[model samples]
Target: FAKFANVNDATSHWPTGEEVFTHLPGTHAHAPLIYVALMTFILIISSVTMVLAVEAGHRMDKKAVIKWMAWTVVGGLIFLGSQVWEWSTFIAGYDGDISTWADNGTLSHSPYGGQWVMGVDAHGHEVKQMVTYGPTLYANFFFFITGFHGFHVFTGVLFNFLVLRNVIRGVYHKRGHYEMVEKVGLYWHFVDLVWVFVFTFFYLV
Candidate 1:
């Protein structure tokens, strides 16, 4: 009888996590899932394209390798430009309605300045109404990780360009090896690995 009563008390009108979060201010939910998804898919597909390029290089199909590398460069540029646009949207907020929130025990908030991030401050409590703030820890991690990956892509394009240059000049043929493509493929794979984690942590969930 006692256990039954306690269980009933605990279950009666209990708010779900969403219900609790519904009252929070900074949960403004300003994400363009479409754009983000496109960018993610593009990067993933480009990784596959790069692998195909590397395989072509391995098989001594210089023409096929060059074609794929050219495509990879274009795809990489597209992804980078998309990210720049995404960042601009985030920074400006949507339709000039930048969200902002402050914790005054009551969760009423405003959207005058962009809600770039929601995170805890020095005392391990959220700085709810961050009107003008740079990268927080989460942003820091995302920037460092993703920015590093972008850097790698940029470098990869440069490396691929050089490889193409050498290939066109019959350098690889003279050397009788495709080690350059093989080595760069390893770096490309690392970029893909980092992106998988970023997509999971940042976008998916």
Candidate 2:
């Protein structure tokens, strides 16, 4: 990648690597896969809980509905929290030593960039350099996409919380059915399924 960037920098007449880093979209090659996998797992489990809640609602099982709904809410919270951690780590960027060549034919070490590069030092020892200043658009688009989904999760949590509160107050019990749980369950399921697409296109693909 470093060689490619250097060759492009040397040849390109248009905007190239010499200027601000140019970022292309759909580059999930370096994304944290394990964290994404965990989040997917949690959301899938939450969807299952929603299905169980809807079934309990059909049977007018208030206790079962409340229990499953609570579990769903917990799952949503955990997913959101994981996202917070992931975002923080991403924004922090990579931490490593970098190498740069000066105009005076001298090489030096730096901590500027997080990307790795191979080079030789004054003693003819091979060393690794890091590339800094990643493309801004990549991070911007990432935040926009993930942040939007995070907001949806936040609202879903609040919605579930309200319904859970009502359940505890016996409103559904007096009404002789847990229809509200079923309704919210539908929305929750939709959100969970949409996230699968987001995870695939944004993180895995």
Candidate 3:
């Protein structure tokens, strides 16, 4: 829908239609991107820990595998917690009314700030209305896509915990291998890679 959007059309713009459907520079909501960078770093480090765990498993070192897997699990937990905080903050909106726009020949006000309202248009089509405070669609996509990835992280942690349990039980040792650790490590690393792309496209860009 965004590809063929009419950039000059007022309907294409946000609430009050003073601006288009894109992040404007110098806006208050365009705060520092530090948290996203930190999240990326955390996930990337977790991938490295998974790699170390896999290497330890390859060498039949149960103690080393347990240590590295524990670190990887810790990293995943931290990342998931941070994502929850970010979602909460976004849903809460900004502190005060920030929507300002020039309509026709006069300035007007949209008091809701970044809040989004849904209603039927005159033509009976469903519409997602946004104020000048920020893009509502952006928040929607962010929540859905990032929330999905966060769920993946949560499940990856569970998988890691299960393998860690088996490691402690000497199951892999009895089998003369730690293939389970390697498999879970691969899944965890793939989760990290997906986050890297999401962070880059959603937060950084």
Alpha carbon lDDT of each predicted model: 0.58, 0.65, 0.66
Task: Pick the lDDT winner.
Answer: 3
Query: Any residue pairs clashing in model 3, and if so which?
Result: none
Model 2, residue 45: distance off in Å is 0.4
What shift in Å separates residue 152 of candidate 1 from its native position after superposition? 2.2
lDDT of 1: 0.58
| TM-score, every prediction | 0.65, 0.68, 0.70
lDDT of 3: 0.66
What's the lDDT for residue 30 in model 2?
33
Off by over 4 Å in 3: 1-31, 94-136
For candidate 1, give the lDDT of residue 7.
37
lDDT measured at residue 78 in model 2 versus the true structure, 0 to 100 = 94
In model 2, where do residues sit more than 4 Å from their true spots?
1-32, 94-135
Write the residue-wise lDDT of candidate 1 on 33-128 in tens digits.
555667778877878888888888778888888788777777778888876765554444444333333442212122455323443431223333
**Model 3 C-alpha lDDT per residue in residues 108-174, reported as the tens digit of each score:** 2333664433333312122223332334454456567788899999999999999998998999989
Clash pairs detected, candidate 1: 101-129
lDDT of 2 by residue, 55-133 (tens): 9888888889889999999999999988886665454432321123422223322235533344443332322112222
Scanning candidate 2 in windows of ten residues, the lowest lDDT window is 15-24
Which pairs, if any, clash in model 2? Answer: 113-131, 113-132
